[model samples]
Target: MSGVAPGASAKGTAARTANESAPVDDAEVVRDSRPARRGPGGPMGGMGMPTEKPLDMRGTLRRLLGDMREHRLELAVSVLLGVASVVLAVVGPKILGNATNIVFAAVISREIPAGITQEQAIEGLRAQGQDRLADMLTQVTFTPGEGLDTHALAVTLGWALLVYLGAWLFGWLQARLTAIVVQHTMFRMRARVEDKLTRVPLSYVDRQSRGDVLSRVTNDVDNLSMTLNQTLSQLVTSVLTVVGVLVMMFWISPLLAVIALVTVPLTVGVTSMIAKRSQPQFIRQWRTTGELNGHIEEIYTGHALVKVFGQTDTAQRVFDERNDELYNSSFRAQFISGTIQPAMAFIANLNYVVVAVVGGLRVASGQMSLGDVQAFIQYSRQFTQPITQIASMMNMLQSGAASAERVYGLLDAEEQEPDPEPAVRLDEVAGRVEFADVDFSYDPRNPLIEGLSLVAEPGQTVAIVGPTGAGKTTLVNLIMRFYEVQAGAITLDGVDTRAMTRADLRGSVGMVLQDAWLFEGTIEQNIVYPIATSPGAPVTPEQRERMLRAAQATHVDSFVRSLPEGYETVITGEGGSLSTGERQLVTIARAFVADPPILILDEATSSVDTRTEVLVQKAMNALRVGRTSFVIAHRLSTITGADVIVVMEHGSIVEQGSHEELLAAGGAYARLYASQFAAAAIED
Candidate 1:
C-alpha cells in the first residue's frame, strides 16, 4: 500500500506548521531555501511560514545509513537471520515434492492386476532378494489389501514439518534483531536533531514557524521509524526469498524458470509506471496538507478576531479551498498506489497458468516427473509473491524517503557560527555600556541603524523614545547579542560585547518585555529560574533568601501571598489566571532576582491598567536606582525622570538630553512629548 493515508498526511502537515498560518509558494518547495523572515512579535511569532524542501533522496538515504554505521554489526546479524529464514521457507516446497514422489512410487508399485495372484507378487519379490518386502507382501495377500509403505510416508511428512518450524523460528529471531537496530538508530537520530536545533542560528529559526521545526523533529522522525521497522526486515526477506525461489525453480525445470522470468520485466514496468504517476500526487498531498494546517491554525488561533471583524465566512471559504486541495491530492496518490497489487497479481497469475501448461506437457513427455512439475509450479507462485509484495511496498518506501529527506534538510541547515576560541570572559561587570558608530539592519538593503553612537555611564538610566519601527527593540536585541551589529562595536566595561561569550554577555543583562511569559511552575520557581538553571554551583540558602527579597521588593510577594498556595501555587497555561499587570510584576521580580548589572525594559508597562502602571512605575524607578538601564517606551511620562532621554526617528537618533532639556529644545522629542500629552488630555 500507499503510505500517503489521509490521516497521516493531515497529521504530518499539522505537525510541520505547528499552528502558525502563512502562505507557502510552490517555488519554495522546489528550491527548498529562503532567507528567514522576522514576523510580528519576534522570530517565532508568526504562523504559516514557507515549508522547507526535501533534500535529494540519495543524499538523505546515504546520510541515514551513515548514522546506522554504529549498529552495523546488529544489522548484519539481522540480515543473516532473515536470509536463513527465507532459505528454509524456500526449501519447504521441494521437501513436500519429495514426499509426493515417494507416495506416488509406492502407489504405482503396489497396484496389482485382478488376474494376478498374491503368490506371484511374493515370488517376484523373492527373486529380487527383497526378503522383508516379500514377507510383507505375503501378509497383504492373505488380507487381500493393497500394501503401501506407511512408515516411509510418515517419515517424509515429519521432515517437512521440521523444515517449516525452522523457518518460523528463524523468522521470529530476525524480527527481534531488526527491532533492536531500528529503535536504537532512531533514538540516536532524534537526539542528534534536537542538538542541531540548539546550534542553528536564531535568524534561521525566526524565519520559520514553530510547526515547521516541530514537524521535522516529531513527524518526520516518526515516519522514518515506522518505515524502517516495517520495511527493513521485509526488504531483506523478500529479496532473499525471490532469489532462493528462482534458484529452486531452475533446479526443478529450467524451461519453466524461463517462463517465470518473463513476468519480471512486466512487473517492474507496471510498478515503475505507477510509482512515477503517484509521486507528484504524494508531493501535492503533503503540500496541501501543510496549507490546510496553516489555514486551520490561523483561523482557530484568531477566531476571536475573525468574529470581531465578521470574517468568519471568509475564513471558512479559505479553509474549504485548502481542504479540497488536500482531498484531491490524497485521493489521486492513494488511487494510483493502490493499483500495484492487483496489476502484479494479474501478471503473476498469467505467468502461473503458462508455467502449469508447459510443465504438464514436459511431465507427459517424460522430460519432467509429476513431483518435479508440482515443485516447479509451487516455486513459480513463491517467486512472484515477493515481487507483488515489493511492488505494493514501493509507495511506502517512497514516502519514507521523502520524510527522511525533509529531516536531513533540517539537520543540514546552517548553524550558528561557533563562539570564538578562548573567548574573553568578563570578571567584574560595572554596567558601563557604549555603542560606537554602530551600523545594523534586519534587511541590508534597508539599513535600520546607521552610524549610531552613545554611552551610558555606570548606574545611569538612559531612556529611548521613538515612534513605531524606530529600531528601539532592535537596539536592545543587539545589546543582548540576539542579533549582531553589521559594523562597529558595543562594549560593556571597556570590552567589546562580541569579544565576550554570548552566554556571559547575556547573563549580565536582564530584560522585562511588554508581553510577560511565565511557564508552568510555582511562583517562586519562576522568580528564581535563573539560579535554578544556572550552570554554576548549586543555589544556596542565601540565594533563596535573595530571591524572596527581590519578589518582595518588586511588590509581587504581596499578591502571591493572597493566593491559596502562595509561592507554591502552580501557574498553568502561560499564567493566564494572572492579571496582565500581575504577570508583568512577576517577570520584573524574575529580573530583579537575577541581579544583572544592566537592565532593559521594553515598554514593560504597556499592557497594564493606569492604576497598576503607576505602581509598577514606582517599583521600576526604585529598581533602576543603582544599575545601568535602557528604557524603551512610547509613554513619555514613564521616562520623565530618566537621566537622559534619547529621541529616535527612522534609524537615527535626532536628539538626546534630559526630558526637560529636550522639551526646551522643541525638536523631535518636544513633538513626541506634545503628541502624547495631547492624547492623554483628550482621554481624561
Candidate 2:
C-alpha cells in the first residue's frame, strides 16, 4: 500500500494538503489537514499587551467590516453606548471639580472676618493694598461662616461618583455587545474559509505554501478574532473620549487645551512610524509560524517513515531552523509593538506638564478659577488616555489585519470549475470508457500525456503496467477529472464525461486507491462509505445483508467476527489496530458494496501477503464480474491475467494486447514481462 506523504491529500484540494503523496503510482490521497495570556492587577492593575502598514490595510479593513455588516445592529448599539460612556466620563471630572471648588471656597470664605459683608471684606483687602488677593477672592463663591458646606460637598461628590459609575456601566455594556459582534463575524469568516477550501483547485493548492494556508485558517483567524474583540471594544470609546475630552478641555481653558492638543500630532506621528517598522515583522512572525506548523505536521504525520529511514536528526535540524526563525520574527514584532505604550506614556506626561503649568498660571492670574483649572488638568489627562489606547490598539489591529489579508488570500483563491448544467446521466447497463486523443499536462511547459487514445470495453479488464512517472496515474487523474485534460475528450458509454456533472461521473465509477485510506469510524461505516456517499445508494432491509455479504466475500468477516464488536469495531486514524492488508480489504469491501459499473484499482493487492493475495484476488474476481476494470498493476501475476495488457513508456502506449498476443509480439510488454520474471527468479 502507498503510505501518506506530506503535501499529499486524501481528497483533491483539501486545503491543498495531503499526508499521502507517493511515487508508488504518482497518485496522492487528497487529505485536508485542518490542523492566550494576561497579567497584573489589584496592586496597580493592567498594562497588557503591528504595523509597517499592512500591504493593503484599507482594503483589508473594508472587507473585514463588510463581513461584519450582518451584526451592524449590535455594533451600532455598542457605538452609541461607547459615545454615551464617553460623555459621562468626560462630565465626571468637571463635576468633581465643582465639589473641590465648593470645599476650597468655603475654607477661604471662613478666613474672612465673621459677620463682614463680602464686598466690604474685598474693599478692606483692596484698601490694605492686597488688590491681587482681593481680586482672587472675588472669584470664590461662599457665604461667611460657610466653613466647607459638608452637605453640599457630599452632594457634589455623589454626583461625580454617579457619573463615573454610569460611565463604567455603559463601557461594560459596550464591551459585551462588541464581543458578540466580533464573535459572530469571526464565526462567519471561519465558515467562509472552510467553504473556500473545498473549492480551491488542486493546482492552486500545490503551488501555494501548505504551511501558509494552515496558518491563515488557524493562527490568523484567531488573531483577527482576538484583535477585533479587544480593539473594537475600546476603539470606539477611546476615539470619542479624545473628541469629548478635547471639547471639555477647550471649554475649561482654550490656551491649555491648545497646548494639550499639540502632543496629539506628535503622538500620531510616532505611532505611525513605529507601526511601519513593526507591521512587516508581525506578518513575518505569522508567516513563519505557519511554515513551522507545516513542517512539523509533515514530519510528525510521516514520522514512521522518518524513523524507518533514520532521518529524525534531519527533521529536527530543519525544525530548529524554522523554530529559530519564528522566534526572531516574533521577538522583533513584539519588541517594536511594545515600544508604543511607553512612548505614548512619555508623550502623555509631557502634555500633562505643559497643560498643568499653563493652567496654574491662569489660576494665579484670576483669569480662571482653581476649580476650572483643576477640571482642565483632568481633561488634559483624559484626552491623552484615549489617544494612547488607540496607539496601543494599532499594534494589535495591524497584526490581526495581517492575518486577515492572509485569510482573504485563501478565500479569494480561484475555485474549481462548476459542475456542468444539464448534466448527462450514466445509469445505464453498458460501461464503455474511452479516452479520445486525450492531451493533458500538470505543467503547460512540460506535457505529460499527448495525443493518447485508449478504450476499456464493457466487462473488460485492462491492466496498465509502466515505469514510474510514465503517466500511469496522470491518465487515471484525467479520467477521474482530478486534473482536467488540456485537450481532447474522455467519454463513458459514448457520453462525454465533461458534460456529466463531476459527482455523477465519479459516482458511476469505484476507485481503490493505493493507500486504502479510511477515516475514524466503525468498520461497517468504512466498508459502506463509498455506497453511503452516493445519493442513490439503496438503504433497504437488505443494506446490512449486502454489507455482511461483501465483508464475507472479501475475507473481512473472518477477522472482523473474531473481534468483540464485529462490524461495529471503531477504527481510528486510517484503521487503528488493523493491519495494512486488513485496511486494503476494507477498501475492497467498500468497492464491492458500491458495485459501480467501472472499477479502477491502483495496486489493490500490493499490501496483502502472498497467501492473502490469492483470497483477495478471488474476491476481486467476483467483484469485477461484468464490470469494466482498469488495474494499474505492479506485479506479473496481476498483469498476465488481464484481458488486455497496455505497456506504457514515457507517457505513450508502446504496446497493447492480451498477455499471449503481446508476448508473441515480443515488444515493450515482453521486455517488461521478462524483467519482472527475472527479478522473481533472482529472489528464488
Candidate 3:
C-alpha cells in the first residue's frame, strides 16, 4: 500500500513543494546563541538604591503592616490583647511605687525630731543606705494609705491575674494567627512563584540553577516563617511595653522622663544605624548561601562526571570559597546585631545613674519627696527594659525584612499572560498540519526560521532533515506551542492551531523525542499517562489487552515479561535502571497506548542498534498506518520510503522531494546520503 492516503490539501502538493524548495540567505545561516528573555524578580522597592543608602526602616515597617492588614481582624485583636497585657503589667510597678510613697511620706510628715535639722535629715541615710531604707519602707508602709487599701490590693491582685491571663490569651492568639497567616501566606507565595515559573519562558530555568530556585522557595520562606511566628509578635509586645512604661515615667516624674528621652533616642539612633549596616550583610549572607546550595546540588547531580574528570579538588576549592564568604557574612551580621543590646544596656545604665543623681538632689531640696524619687527609679528601670528589648527586636526585624524581601520578590514576578480569548476545543482530529510563512527565534532580534512553509497531509510520513541549529528542534517546539510564533500561522486540518486550547492541541498530538524520559512509576502507569488525566475514564480488560499488544509491537513486551513484576515493574526516576534503547522502546509503547492521530518522532530510534532500529521502525510503521507522522532523522536510510522529504539548512529548506527524487537531484540530501551510506552502498 502507498504510505500516503489520498486527501485534498487546501493548497495542493505543488504549493508545498514550492514552500519546501526555497533558498536560504547567508545572513540567516549564522544563528544567535543567546537564550530567550524572562521577567526579572526583586523587592517591590526598586533595585537601584545604592548599597551606601541607609535601610528604609519606615518602608520596611510599612510593608510589614501591609502584610498584617491582609488579616486585619486577627492583627487588631492581637494588638488589643498585647496593649491590655502591657497596661496591667505596668500597673504592677505603679501600685508598688505608690505603697512605698505612702510609707516615706508618713515618715517625712511625722516631725521626726524637734532637733533634727535639714542637713541632719539628709545625713540620716548613707548613699546606698537610701536604697536599702527604700526597700524596707515599701514593705512597711501599706497599712494606712488609701492607695494601699484592701480594695486596691484586691484590685491590683485581680489586675495581676488579668495580666497573666492576657499574656496567655495573647500568646495563644498570636500562635494561632501566626500559624494561619504563615501557612496561608507561604502557600500563596509558593503558588505565585510556581505561576511565574511556568510562564516566564523556559530558557530562564535553563540558565539559572535549580538550586537557587529551590533555596528561595525552601530556605528563604522558612526563615521568614520563623521570624513572623516569633519576632513579629515580640516586636508588637516590645513597642507596647515601651509606650506604656514611658507614660508611667511621665506620670511619676516629668524630669526623670525627660532625662530618659535623651538616652532613648540616642540608643534607637545608634541601633538603627548598626541594623542598617547589618541588613546588607544579611542579604549577602543569604545570597552566598544560595550559591553554595547551587554548587552542592551540582556536585551531587554530577558526581560521576566530576570524579571521572578528576576535578574534585577544583570543586572543593570553589565550594570552600563560597562557604568561607557565607561564614564571613554571617559572622559580620551576627556580630553587628549582637552589639546593639550591650550598647543599649550601657546607655540604659548611664541613664539610671543620671536619674538617681538628679532625683536624689530634688528630694533632698524638698522639691520632691523620697518616695517620689523611689517611684521615679522604678519607672526608670521599667522604661529601659523595653528600650533594650526594642533594640534587640529591631535587629531581628531587619534580618526578617531581608529574607521577606527575597521571598516577596519571587512571589511578585510577572508571568507570561495567558491568551485572553477563549480557545476552541476539539473532540477528535484529522491529522493534517500546515506551517505558513513561519518566522521564529528564541531571541526576537535573530530569527531561527524565516519565511519557511510546509505541510503534512493525513496519513502521510514527512521526513525533515537538517544540520544542528538548523531549526529542526525549534520546528517541533513550535508545533507543540512551547513557544508562540513571531509572524506566522500553523493550521491543523485547515483550522488555525492558535485557536485551539493548548491542552486540546497537545491532547490530540503525541511526541517521542530523542530523550525518552520515563518518570518513576510502573510500566502500566507510564503507558496509561494520557488516559489517566480524566479520573472518570476507566480502563477495561480490553484496553489492557490492546496495551499489551502495543508493547509487543515495540518489542518491549519480552523485556517487560522478563521483569519480576512484568507489567507492574516499577521504573526508577529517569529510568535509571533501563538502557537507552530499552527506555526508547517503552516511550514508543507509551505513544502507542495513547494512539493519537498525529505523531512527531525526533530521531526516536537513534539510540538503538541497527537490528533493534529495524524492529522499532517496523513498530513505527504500524503506528503510523492511519496517522500523519513527522520524523526527524540523522540516519537517512530509515526514512527512504517516506511520502515527502523536506531538507533544511540553517533554518531554511534548500531543497525537498521524495527520497528517490532527492537522490537523483544530488543536492544537500544527496551529499548527506552519500557520506553516510557509501560503505553500506558497497555492501548492498
Best-fitting candidate, scored by lDDT: 2
Model 3 TM-score? 0.79
- Tens digit per residue, CA lDDT, model 1, 1-684: 011111222232222222111223322332234444222112222324443343355676677789889988988898889888898899999888877766655654556444556677667767988765564443221312344567776987898899899999999999998889889999998998988976775556555545446656777789889988888889889999999998898888888998899989999999989998887676556555545554565576568799999999998887777678779878988899989999999999999899989987776555776677788888898899999999988777766776776677678788866777788997888999999999986555456689999999989999998876666766776786656788999999989988888778877877777766676777777777666754223456876797789888888888888998987778876575788898888888878877788988878898899998987897787677789999988899999999989988766888999988999999999999888767455453
Give the range of the ten consecutive residues with the poorest summed lDDT in model 3: 1-10
Question: Candidate 3 at 610: error in angstroms?
Answer: 4.7
TM-score for each of the candidates:
0.83, 0.87, 0.79
Candidate 2 structure quality by residue, lDDT tens digits, 1-684: 111211232243232112112232433211122111111111111111122234677789999889988888888899999999999999998998888789778878888867877788888889999887777677667776658888988998899889989999999999999888888889988999988886766666654555556767898899999999889878888889988998898788788888887887899899999998898888777767777777776786689999999999998988888789789989999999989999999999998888778877777667888888788888888888888899999889888888888788778777878888778786683889998998876545445678999999999999988776677766666676777777899989899888887667777777776676777788887777655643234344566788899999888899899999887888987678998888888888888888888888777887679887887788788778889988887786865788888888777888899999998998888888788778455453
Clashing pairs in 3: none
In model 2, which runs have C-alpha deviations exceeding 4 angstroms? 1-54, 113-117, 127-135, 427-430, 531-546, 679-684
lDDT of 2: 0.77
Highest TM-score scorer: 2
TM-score of 2: 0.87
Give the per-residue lDDT digits (tens) of candidate 3, residues 289-352: 6667777877876788999999999988888887897799899988999899999889989999
